[model samples]
Target: MRKIVTVADDADLAHLVDLIDMLPGPDTRSFWGEGSNSIGSKVGHRLREILSGRGDSSDVDYLAIYVLKYLGRGNRHIPEDRITANLRGASGLPAAGHAWVEDATRTAFTLVTRYSLPVWNGAHRTRGSAWLQG
Candidate 1:
C-alpha cells in the first residue's frame, strides 16, 4: 500500500510532519484527494483515527465513493428533512400531528423542561442505557 498524508494547512501540516518524524519509524504517505461518500463508515473511522492521533487516509478513496453515492448527506441540497417531516406525518404513526413534528415537539419539550424536576430522569437514563445496549 502507498503512504498517506493528512490534508492540512501550513501550521497543522508542519506540526504533523514533526510529530511523524519523531515516531520510531521512518515513513511517507500520499493523498489521492478529498472526502467522498462511498466510504461513509470508513471515513467516519478515519476521522476518529485523525481525532485520536492516528495518521492514515487510505479511507479517502472509499470516502470519495461514499460522497458520490450520497452527495447531499452532508448538505441539505434537497431540504430532505422538511420533505421527510411531511411524509412521516402522513405515515399515520399516531404521532402528535406527525412523526417529524412529534419528534421535534417532543425534543423541544425535553429541552424546555431542562429546568424541571428529575421526573424524566428515568426516561432519559433509559435512552442512554439503550444506546449502550445497541
Candidate 2:
C-alpha cells in the first residue's frame, strides 16, 4: 500500500525536508541524485523513496510521512498532540527512544511555534469546518 496520501508542491517538499532534518535521529542513508550533495536533497530523496515503498523505512520515516500528509492536506498548523497520538498508533513504530517520534514532534512543534515559518496561524480551511459557514 502507498504510505504517502497527499501531494505537495516543490516548496512544500523543501520545507518538509527542513522539518525532518531538524529532528535528532539517525541520518538518511539513501544515495541521492548525482551532484546533489546537499543534506536537504538527500532527505528529500529518502522521503520520496519511503513514500514510493522502494526503500527501507524506519519509525522516523513513518512520522515524517504522517506529517507530510497533514501538511499537504492544507493544515497550516500541526498540533503536537495529534501528531503524538497518530505516531503512537502507527504500526511498526517501536515504543522506544530510538523510534524518534518524540524528537520529530519536538522539532515540528518548535518550527511551527517558535519560527512560525512552515506552519502559520491564520484563517485557513480545515477538514469538516465548512459546516460553520452553513
Candidate 3:
C-alpha cells in the first residue's frame, strides 16, 4: 500500500492575511488602494477578504501581487532593472520649460497606470519581451 500525503500548512497564507490587516485603510495619507469605486480598490479589497478565508478564490492569483506588495512582499514579477530603466528613460526627456514638465507628468502617469500594473500582475506572462520593447 502507498500512502498519500498533502502539504496542508497555510502558514504563508495566514501570514499574508496578517500583513494585509496591517495595511492602512483608504483614508490614510499613504494609502494606495486607488479610488473608492475604482476596479483596483475593489480587486484589492476582495483579495484581502479571499486571503482571510472570508471570500472565494475566483481571481486570487491575478490580483494577489497587487495587494501583496503593500504587505512588504514587494513586486516579484517585474524586474527591478526594467523598472529602473523605464523611469530613467522617462526622466531623461528634454525639459522645454513648464510644458515639458507637464508632458513628463502625463507620461509618468500613463506608464504607471497602464504598463507597470499589467506587467507586474503577469498579464503579459508569455510576452514579457513585449513590455521591454515599450
Candidate 4:
C-alpha cells in the first residue's frame, strides 16, 4: 500500500462511505464477529458512525488507511502485494474479478489525491524537495 496523506473532511468521508457500502463483504465465515456479519459493509457503517459529527482528524486519517486497505485487494482476491498483505491480511476470494472493485479503487484513489500532500521519495531526494518548496 502506498503511503497517503489523508485530508478528507466529513463530506469527503461520507462520500467514501457511500462508495464502500456498494461493495459486497468478504465471504468468509470467520470474518464475522458477534454482531457484525459483513466486513465491507461494516467498515463503511462504522466509518459513518464515526464521521457523523463525532470523529476527529485522527479518526479520519486512520479510516482513510482502513478504507484503502479494504479496497486494495488484487484480482486474485488477496492483497497480492506483500506489504499490504502483511499489514492488512489476505482479502479472501469474494470480491475478486469484479468490475466494481476497479471502480471503487479508482474512486478511493481520486478522493485521496484530492487532498494529499506531495510526498518526497527517498530515492529521489537528490533532486531536492521541490514539491514541498513550492
Candidate 5:
C-alpha cells in the first residue's frame, strides 16, 4: 500500500529554501548555480515566483529530488520540531564570519536529512499527493 504525504506548506518551503541559501561556496554553486555573494536574493526571487504560482514546478521538484536523493532515511523518522529548533538555535548565534555560515550549513544539512527527505520520499512514492496542488 502507498502512504500519502502532505506537501510542505509555504512557510516550510520558504524555510527549506532559506536553509539552501545558507549553504557555503561550492555547495551553493553546485546546488543553486550561483555564488554565495547574493544567493539569498536570487533564491528569494524564485521563492516569490513559486509562491505566486509563476515558477516552474520542475525547478521546485529539482530541489526536492536533490534533498531526497542525498538525505533520505530508511526507517527512521526525525521530528520537524527538532529540526526547527536547531535552525532557530543556529540563527540565534552571533555572526562569526565563516563559522556562522558553517553552522547554518550544518543545520540545513540536518534539516534536509531528517525532515525534508521523508516528505519528498513519500510524495515520490505516491507520485504526489493532494497537498502538492499549488
Candidate 6:
C-alpha cells in the first residue's frame, strides 16, 4: 500500500485553510472543496515553466515552497542540470514530467498527490479538515 502525505492533522489543515482564504485574487490561488476549484496543476505547470526560465518567478513564494517541499514532492523532482534539458524537450516549458524524478536523474519514481483521503468512515478525515474555512 502507498502512503498519502496530506496534512491529516485538523489543526494544521485549519491553519492552512485560513491562510489560503487570505489570498487576494481568484486566479492566484487554488482553494479546493465542493465548489472550490483545485487548480494546483496549473500553478505547478506554470511554476515549472518559470523555474526553467520560460516565465517569471512571481508566484514562487515561501508558502508555495513550504507545501511543495514538505506536504508534496517538490524538491524531489527535476535535477538542476535536467531543468534545461527538460525545458528543451518540453518545447515551451510545461511540467518537466507528469511524475517527479530524483532531480538530474532519468529514473522516475512514483509521485502520488500526497493528498489525504476520507478515512475511518469519514469521521477522522472530516474532523481533521474543514472545507468551510475558505
> Which candidate comes out best when scored by TM-score?
4
Per candidate, the number of residue pairs that clash is 14, 0, 0, 0, 0, 2
Q: Each prediction's Cα lDDT score?
A: 0.34, 0.41, 0.39, 0.47, 0.43, 0.33
Scanning candidate 6 in windows of ten residues, the lowest lDDT window is 104-113
Give lDDT tens digits, candidate 5, residues 23-133. Answer: 432333433344444333444454555556555544354444443333222212222232333333455344432343344445445544444456667755654556787
Candidate 4 RMSD computed on C-alpha atoms after optimal superposition onto the true structure? 9.8
TM-scores of the candidates are: 0.26, 0.24, 0.33, 0.43, 0.30, 0.21
Q: Is candidate 3 or candidate 6 better by TM-score?
A: 3
Model 6's alpha-carbon lDDT is 0.33
Model 1 misplaced regions, further than 4 Å: 9-42, 50-57, 72-134
Tens-digit lDDT track of model 4 for 47-131:
6546465554444554555556654546332333422323232353334324345555665565555434223245336444566
Question: What TM-score number comes out for model 3?
Answer: 0.33
> Which segments of model 6 are wrong by more than 4 Å?
5-8, 26-64, 67-134
The order by descending TM-score is 4, 3, 5, 1, 2, 6
Highest lDDT scorer = 4
- In terms of lDDT, the poorest run of 10 residues in model 1 is 23-32
Sort the candidates on lDDT, descending order: 4, 5, 2, 3, 1, 6
How does residue 82 of candidate 5 score in lDDT?
26
Residue 100 miss distance in model 4 (angstroms): 2.3
Candidate 2 lDDT over 30-115, as tens digits, reads: 21123465433544565766456453423234434445333322334333333333333343334432344454444444333433
